[model samples]
Target: MNNIKSVFSINDLENLSGIKAHTIRMWEKRYTIFSPNRNTNNVRFYTTNDLKKILTIAFLNNFGYKISKIAKLSETEIISLAQKIYSDKTDSNFAISKFKLSMFNFDAKLFHETYDKLLETKDFEIIFYEVFIPLLDEIGFLWQTETLTPIHEHFISSLIRQKLFAEIEQAQKNANFSSNEVYVLFLPMGEIHEIGIILVNYLLLKKNKQVVYLGENVPMENLTTVVHHFNKVNFVSYFTVQPEEENLNTYLDTFHQNILVNSPHKLLVLGKQVHNFTSFIPSIQCFTSIKQMLNTI
Candidate 1:
């Protein structure tokens, strides 16, 4: 019980719901939607339940339901309405809301259940781009604002990583590796964000391409082993951080000089940090997304 986060500020509510703090306060005064409690410091705080209810309300309101109408419905009715949207239209918004609810409540069951439901109607790639990516993007903002803790972030990331691994395993069974260009995936040294690269591995494997997933904070020199082994290779990475903007050009120069200067191998990259890159030779390419990389290779 001590590990549970039981309360949230209005700012937390805003960050999670994508609703304005002013709008939430207006909803409170105009309707009986919230009854926030005061802490010892007299700061207004809401329960986990309040956050859930607000998320549901926001979900419903987004689909043309008026707040005045939503205010009159019972909690069950509101949730039923939200559920009906996903049921009838297969709305991604409701799934995103359900995921956020699961994260807040630490409900692994709900997370899996929601994911399984999505799988019934959508392919893994669609679900990933539509549901998971947007949720992760919002989660990043929420964490930056202190609306969520590391515990919450880790809980959801672990769940998603589990799914990625499961899917990657399935892809591995069908991998032919007949393509001459063997792909090598890794994160830069001093970098630890690996979800993107793991997904890239699964994507390549799904296409029957060969991939060697070195994974998470790999030094540049480590590539010599694969370089020595595979005659044709495409070294892939997703740079969320590490290789700071100031160091990006220098890092690219070093990698090109050492890894691809005279060799036939190439480097393919995807991530926000690559926008910091200045210039690169034809052998070194940076992608804005996994989709773009797929289209190219």
Candidate 2:
């Protein structure tokens, strides 16, 4: 079956195109840029074709094209202009914009093509840091602001995760180090976000360290067992949404009493929830960002 998106709401367009829903309504009302189908309840719905057209319109508008002029352009003309913008190799922002289009269309081909083209001039790390990271930040903002849906976020995140895992597997195969420290990565219970931890795992492998990746939603009770098994263990975790502000200290205290008190190990944490604590458990280190964590690792 084709993965083409056949139905969309105004919010979907707003999320995918970075155009406000109010502005989209204005374009539809004033310039007839979109001819949406309304349901019995009078809710607006759009087809995949509308999605494509709006993506082009948004891209052109970003380039200073007037809405009045854009509304008059033929479909072929708009598509040609979009293709030109997509092919502009000098604009890094265009790369991100194209990826947003791909996410909206569920077009994996577009994502792969854009990434491969970028790899011609830069390595994966550079593309990730410069393009993908900023793209992710935008996606997060869109999700938070209710402009993007979970489906849209998941589509892009899953593709980027595949690349991260591929790199990690390759690194693991070639990794050889004499360091006795074994890094164990996991997400706390109730916390399902693992991309940050996965990236950290990749970084650890790249630095020639051994990583025992337990993955997401690991039980806190298991940490003691893991530490007991390894001679020199370094527990690494990402707290994206787990361990609520009130529970953060309690969780750390649990780890302090159960794992660190009896073992000779260190805890390194990275996430948005790390700063809510007034104090950290002994032997625990909190990082504000990926770069800070990478520097210490």
Candidate 3:
């Protein structure tokens, strides 16, 4: 809990709040809004309280309130105005701020409320691209910078996975695939990142394609067994932290020999590792991002 409430540098605030450090400094000096503490080296930092205050102010500012006007309002008044703003309507930026605030405090209510509010106006696809994607990208940066904890990461990710699963189930009920093409989605063995694959499943369902979701860390042989049974199999995998960087090429070779050789199956791969490979064997397509894969799908 203490880790979750830890302090953040000015740069972190800038990253998390989408406010420039220079602007934050100017507001601090002119409006006396946030009283951040300074370290022994005179480097300034802010507490969780300061972060929440800035998020609230940023939220209000998005609703057409001027910085000067926001600085003049008391914290209580700021909260009041923010609540009103939130109740009426919100955009992507406001939704991101609310999501960040919820993640920081582990406040499920705020997270659900923000998501529910977005659902009132937008569909699942709109929310995923506009809200969840940006929020996840920010969360990744926060994790990289040590501003957020594993607990925080898991909390938000689990909630999102739940929503994705619900949406996927709902979409799958009415799938209308004309072709017998089956998409077999999974992460490579030793790779555990399934969010990319999960999103792929959702998109494939939206395309009304048959999806055989094998999910995370599936073995190459298991994939082969599954593909052997299907006449038109499109094996998709997200290569996040697997296929050992030193042996990525070797892993691809093994995958090709075992899965694609003498078979009509096409392998579609994505993630950080996929970028490192300069070339791929025949029938193997490497995608840099989900959007690129979406085009092919």
What is the descending TM-score order?
A: 1, 3, 2
What tens digits encode model 3's per-residue C-alpha lDDT throughout 1-297? Answer: 535546789988887887899999999899899888999999999988899888888778767899889887789999888877776776787788877888777889988888998888899888998888888888888889777788887888888898899989998998898688899988877887677789989988998899989888787887768865779799888887788789888877888888788878888989888785765487888888888888976
Kindly list the per-residue Cα lDDT of model 2 for residues 107-160, writing each as its tens digit.
899999988888877888888888988898888887786655788878899999
Give lDDT tens digits, candidate 1, residues 120-150: 8999989999999999999889878988887
Better of 1 and 3 by TM-score: 1
Choose 1 or 3, whichever is better by lDDT. 1
Reference-based TM-score, model 3: 0.89
Q: Candidate 3 — worst ten consecutive residues by lDDT sum? A: 1-10
Name the regions of candidate 1 deviating beyond 4 angstroms.
Answer: 1-4
TM-score of 2: 0.84
- Candidate 2 wrong stretches, greater than 4 Å: 1-6, 41-43, 90-92, 141-152
Report lDDT (CA) for all predictions. Answer: 0.89, 0.83, 0.84
Query: For model 3, how big is the CA root-mean-square deviation?
Result: 2.5
